[model samples]
Target: MNIKQYLDSTYLKTAQQANLTEMENTKVVQHFIQEAIDEDFKLIMIRPDHVKLANDMILKHKSKVLIGTVIDFPNGNSDLEPKLQQAQTAINDHADELDFVINYEAFKNGEITLIKTEIIACAKLALSNKKNIKFIIEVAALSNHQIIQICALIKNTIIANFKEENFANIFVKSSTGFYTTINNLPNGATLETIILMLENSNPLPVKAAGGVRNIDDALTMIQLGVKRIGTSVAKTIADGHVSNENY
Candidate 1:
């Protein structure tokens, strides 16, 4: 397999941490877009504001690298209206895919209906726009049973409301790489969690995100039937280097 084709090289940092200003961040995003083009990776995920910057660069170079953006990132606590607005903005900026953070807190609180509504709304909006959607469940924050339950909820909801063919465009991603832990747990995708997600999310692809640091681990994820790998070190993995930068 061409490992680069399965990699979604990701960088979701905001301006203050990523650079001195938004303009500098655009330059950094442009560099990322060029790297994705050169490496021929499947996608490059960035914050919504830089989606246009990425799209502009990709078009300028006549590259096939897809542009993806994160919505309700790290926290799924945003209300539905704002989330929809943000997603619309990303769409207008030419994002090809959108990864949304699901409201696990609501699910854990027995608010299943609320979680379902939020996901359906976001998924429908993106799917209607011909953009792919991946819901980040933040696997590190839940138990194994919770993981299975959340995935099943999403799977069942999608099949009920959306056409079966649209399943290929939706995913249950492993993590957002930005959740607080009870005892300082590892905050990225784990093998056992990925397996659980893969088994539970039928028909829909599973994206292993967060802590993938090397080619060997990435290959392991692919071997487990994972359709996509999201990481800060995708280039390093494709080039056979071990990545130390933790997303």
Candidate 2:
């Protein structure tokens, strides 16, 4: 596909949620969201705290927008209950979709059942209000074999959630930027891996995140079959094409 066509497609702008604690940080996020809205980017992924800010910005600018937020975030050690509560709170705050991390330890320990149960519980919590939930499997931490296993767990959990609640809008994500090993997301290989996983399992959508920094990287992933691209670099890419911006 052409670079511009891919650039014009759906990708996500991620504002580190923990940074929302400060006024300046929030303002920067708001500014980026506005720019993305003006450019008509596909989606904007912000921290839970920025939901109201993002929603207000979209309304003020008269732009139609889709909102996404993460649950359990960079680390997967948090108990499932709190993660479930966080997902519930995100939905209440008007997030259109949710992304969350799976319990890595459970999968690493070969406790497949526990992993399935945990994801199902969290997915259930998000769907309790009939919200769309996507699971972040932290692909950066998983070995090739573990990646497939994790995907299997996610597939089963998604099926289970659907059978019980029938609200299965699950997505498999690549990485949470919080972890050092994947502080940067591998573009080509990661996209290929995700495609392989999808081909082997049910056709759930996949989100490619972590180190996406430019238009080329974003386009490459999209061409490779990634339905979503997550990054903090949207402003950088947009700025490269526009003039007279306050830096």
What are the lDDT scores of the predictions, listed in order? 0.90, 0.66
Model 1, position 94: C-alpha lDDT score = 95
TM-scores, one per candidate = 0.96, 0.79
Where is model 1 more than 4 Å wrong at Cα? none
Candidate 2 regions with alpha-carbon error over 4 angstroms = 1-21, 160-168, 182-189, 235-247
Candidate 2, residue 47: how far the Cα is off, in Å: 1.2
Residue pairs in clash, model 1: none
Candidate 2 all-Cα RMSD:
5.1
Local accuracy of candidate 2 as per-residue lDDT tens digits, 48-144? 8787878888888887657778787767778877887888888888887788878886789888777777877876776666666777777667777
